[model samples]
Target: MSQNWKFFKESVRHFWQVGSLVQSSRYLVDSLLADVDFAESRLIVEFGAGNGCVTRELLRRMRPDARLFSFELSQVFHEEISSIAARDPRLTAVHGCAMLAAQMFAAQSVDCVVSGLPMGNFGKCAKLGVLSTVHAVLKPGGHFSQFQYSLLDYRLMKRHFPAVRLGYTPLNFPPAFVYNCVSA
Candidate 1:
């Protein structure tokens, strides 16, 4: 919780630009990856992919035909994702709000959406906007994966996804829960 200034500033910059927080621990990385059901996916999108940490991991784990569309608002992080995106045909980093997920992406087009944004950080209106868009973009049987700092959003999550499972990661700084927000 008591993060260094340099790292903290860098994280804020990346997040202000990209919409995600930085995770310094390798254990956090492993936990995020383990919860993802990548084997059945072809179209993958990441919301709030800051600095491309999870995006890079998604690239490494995804199948050959899978395409990744990463949405980050921060220009700094967008440039970072773009720099790497150019090297691979499967990747694309879009500078936009995840709240516009429906219009930005074709309806029911995504097979999986892995979110890194802190949904709890948003206001009720803004939070609902992003959730609605997420629901519209995912195909039936598609999974919307996200991790949270606590189980505070459990009720709303169940309303959004057909199935929602809670798992703990004490290894994460301050400890966190990975919510597999699966759609009906």
Candidate 2:
């Protein structure tokens, strides 16, 4: 009962600040996968997989040998992810900060990184730390994709990646811009 309340409140709090917005038609789970090519990836990592929305899609598209590691902070959301994590050997639910990604994953090990984290909520230091860690874990040609409410960081993505591609999903409530980045 208390757990449910915690989930509800946390969802509400972060939703307004950063949670999945149905009005914007943005459900972190599904939208993130619309453009992914699962055949090109075997080891996938997800940053800030809230409510396993995109997580589930990754699992669904994965090859039989594929593995998924998702990082989530909220205990409530963590628990939600764990519910499915335990059922699938391919899914590893990591309860920790996104900044620790490189430590948790082997160097140059990930093929694709899909983040649901709201960079808008974090400071510049945090964005750099987390993105650096992402660069550390990504293979030389690995891709990084993240969505934001605005186009404030296309240049930042360019600095971090060799190439950056932009796409928009107006279906999401308030609309969203997806940044598709790859290591140079």
Model 1 RMSD in angstroms: 3.4
> What is the C-alpha lDDT profile of model 1 across 1-184, one tens digit per residue?
2323433566675544322344525555566667567788899888987667788888999998899999987676678789879988899889888876788778998898888777767778977887888889998888887777778777888888778877678876657777777787
Would you list the clashing residue pairs of candidate 1?
Answer: 17-74
Model 2 misplacement above 4 A: 1-8, 14-31
lDDT of 2 at 86: 89
Any runs in candidate 1 off by more than 4 Å, and if so which? Answer: 1-7, 12-21
Lowest-lDDT window of 10 residues in candidate 2? 20-29
lDDT of 2 by residue, 1-184 (tens): 4543554577677664345543223353455566566888899999987767677778988988999999998777789789989888899999888777888888999998999887877789988987898889998988888888888877888888888778888766558888888775
- Score every model by TM-score: 0.86, 0.87
